[model samples]
Target chain A: MDSTCRRMRAEILDISFSSGHGHIPTCFSVVECLYAAYEVMRHDPKRPDWAERDRFVLSKGHAALGYYAVLAQHSYFDIKEVAGFGAYNSRFGCHADRTKLPGVEASTGSLGHGIGIAVGMALGERVAGRQTKVFTLIGDGESNEGSVWEAVMVANNVGLNNLTIIYDHNKSQGRCLPVTNPGERFRSFGCEVVEVNGHNVDALKEVFARPATGVRAVIADTVKGYGCKTLVDNVNEWHRKSPDAEQLAKLLEELHAPAI
Target chain B: MRRQFKETTTALAATDPRVAVVLGDVSVYMFMDFHRANPGKFYNMGICENSLISVAAGMTATGMRPFVHTIAPFLTERSLEQIKLDCAYNQWPVNIVTCGASFDYAWDGATHHCYTDLAILRLLPNMEVLQPGSRREVDALMRATYDSGKPTYIRLSDHPHDVETNLEFGKGTVLREGKSGVTVMTAGPILPNVMAACEDLDVNLVYFHTLKPMDRALVERFRHDRILVVHDAFGLQEAINEVPGLRTWYHGLPDQFCAWYGTVHDIRARIGLDAPGIRKAVTTLLETPSA
Candidate 1:
């Protein structure tokens, strides 16, 4: 991993561990997706709401730390704001709050609402005569929601070629269940579905860079805790469990030391 | 009144690019012309009311002022959390226009009946709830809604009302002035029934088109001493609570769902919301002195 991605991951680890309030497994899984998304998606940290800037909404919002880390690294706000993650008086809520963060597009912690919100933005951007693309990161588990399907129809019907969704296809859903193949469903909805290895940042960036023929869904095959050995081996347990101080320090040293 | 809403909205959207209509798969007849004229601006968001509302909120982010249309029950009650969290919480100026209030779809059963929209919406922080009584009130309210710059809900009824309306958004119009002893205030399509019920009485008649920023001063003054409030939905009691002291008589639907299936008048009469019912309640109350 590069130094910038490593540093962002370390910051996510520290904030989640310190706050004792974050979707750690979910956050770790999408580090590469976020790393790659910002690479291809157009955005200026200084002008978050610039009329022509591409908009990204974290539909699976419990993993807000992962998104927040990227925003911090991009200099949207001081890195110090990350230290207060999940605090009583902090802007960083357990779920993403748009009012609290400038770059955060929609206040989405609820499952199934993000893609619809993104499609709305795509619709709005189209009507306004802007070429800004809309990107959304949705969990594989979130695809089960009926509203997600509802949004899929709208996107395909409207031919939202400006919108792209990268599904964090981590296979396992809540330990008890597993996710079915998403490509078939997305393809059935008339979306141009593409399968890719989510951990490969270069591959993730390549798919988004292509000319979107229609509403595209990139099904990213990922592990729940991709980088850290501790969380990945026990993905369900670590999904909501933030590491304690000693566990966090040992994991951070291993992750930051770059032997993974 | 619903036809007035349809005409005003479609006409306004032609001239104003900022105006957009979002639907949860209701009111297709009213919006057929709108869809053809402005296809990009019209969004038929299917039957998912929750997604419909949140999508409308998202549209507002990109410099579009959205007007969401649907059946009153589904728009306000089914997806109420989205209205409060997505729209009102962020103070997005989206207009939620609802059709079929009270017993408008009474025979369609309990699911189609919406009697709690006013009460539920009135509790939200930045929401202004309005149930206009006539076509003119609908026209005036729609004009004001475009510029209000806050989340607003416009509840309309199939039944029409004519009470000489002058609907200034937050203020009420005095239809009849009487001695200080009695004041009868009502809102929405039920105003006509209230008007007929109070014909023989020497009481003040005040009509409110806007429910949230209600004429609080008028209510505090007239209702503080003695007043009778007639509202189509469950919000009358809460609207009266704004001014503490009062000998108040409220006529509204009960909190429970309407389980009975009947015509609009049958259900309204059964629930004591019809002309005879209002007259009986008003006459009995008028006989008593102010506490």
Candidate 2:
């Protein structure tokens, strides 16, 4: 693994322990993907707020610590702010508050809402004659909301070529994975569905490179706990388990090591 | 009254490129002028109320000022989540204009009557609810809403009526001024009933055109003594509850599905909201002083 990716993983593991919960692991895996993407686009010489820059929204805002850590890696904000996660008057919290955080487009915490907000932003950008692209990451469980489908239909109906919706298909939300396949369901809504290994940084990079002409849904098949060997494949209990001293040491060691 | 809204929205859309009017498959009778003038901006988003509001929210986020027109029930209740999250939560300046307030669709059945819209909307943060009593007031409110730059819900009546007094945003208009015995606060099409009930009585008639802000000064002054609230819908009770130190007697229906029946007059009389019912409630309250 590169130094930047390793550093972000370590920061995510540290912040995940702040809440003393295990949900940080899933957040860490996604952040690793985001950090890798940001690194590739660092010296592209494009405007920071360029109309064509790829946009990302964390639909599952409860895992915002992971997002903030990745943003810090990209120098979107000071890295020191990560320590203030969930602290008094901290912008970084369990859920993303758009009002407080820069580059955080929509204020999302209510499930099944982030995708709709992103669709609006994408449509807005398109209507404004901007060629910018929009990407929103939602939890598989959030698909339970009917508004998600409402957004899916709108995105496809309007031919939102600039929008890409990613599903963090961890297969475990609170207790178990939903019985239905989210990717196929998104396809039914007229989205170009892409199923990829969420942990594979290369795969995510490839998916991000292509903006769908008609809404796209990338089903990122990620494990609930991805990094630490013991917790990597564990689905049910690891959704949110705070790391103990021993577990923390193992996670830190694994993060410092090379890519598996 | 409906044509007035269509004309105002159509005129505004002509000059303003950012103005888009979205309807829920029911603009045929209301928005012919707007469609003729600005074909690209006018969209009938089918019968999907949820999608209509969501699309309007999206349009608002992008810099377009969208006016969404539909029936009161579907606009307020059916797609309530979209209204709360997409518009109120985001604080998008989308004008939600409902054409038939309070039994305008009386014959359409119980599902179309939107008596609970005001009550439900008042609970949302940063949403301004307006119930215009007259055609003039409706036009003035619509014009102001286009420039107000706030998330607003303008509840319009089906029939036309005369504006006894000029109505303003966030301020209740005094239709009949009487001594401080008992004040009757009402809104929308029920204003005529309230006016009739206040004639030759020692009761003040305050018409609450705006529902959300609730005119704190007006409420405080009226709250000094006894007050009787005669709302066309059930949700006005929640608004009255915010005022302190007042004996409030609610004159609306109970919090349940309204039974489908005849006109607004028939439903009002059946549910004890007519001039006679309001007169008796006011007279009874004024005759007896609080302990």
lDDT by residue for model 1 (B110-199), tens: 888888899899999989989888898999889988658788999988887876887788888888887758788888888888988888
DockQ agreement of candidate 2 with the native complex: 0.42
lDDT of 2 by residue, A162-183 (tens): 8878788777654554637777
lDDT of 2 at A144: 71
What is the per-residue lDDT of model 1 for residues A1-260, given as tens digits with 9 covering 90 to 100?
65777777788888877787777778877888888888888899888878989989888988888889888877888767877888888998888788878899888877888888888888889889998899999998887777788788888887889999889998767555556878998999999999998888888899988998899999998888767788778887777887889989877877766576
Off by over 4 Å in 1: A172-177, A257-259
Report lDDT (CA) for all predictions: 0.83, 0.74
Tens-digit lDDT string for candidate 2 (B53-147)? 87787677667888888898888998788788778887777899897668877777788888778888878888888888777888788777765
Query: Which residue pairs does candidate 1 place in steric collision?
Result: none
- Interface Cα RMSD per model, in Å? 1.5, 2.2
RMSD in Å for all candidates: 1.9, 3.1
Give per-residue lDDT, candidate 1, residue A81.
81
lDDT of 2 at B90: 72
Error of 1 at B112 (Å): 0.8
Per-prediction DockQ scores? 0.60, 0.42
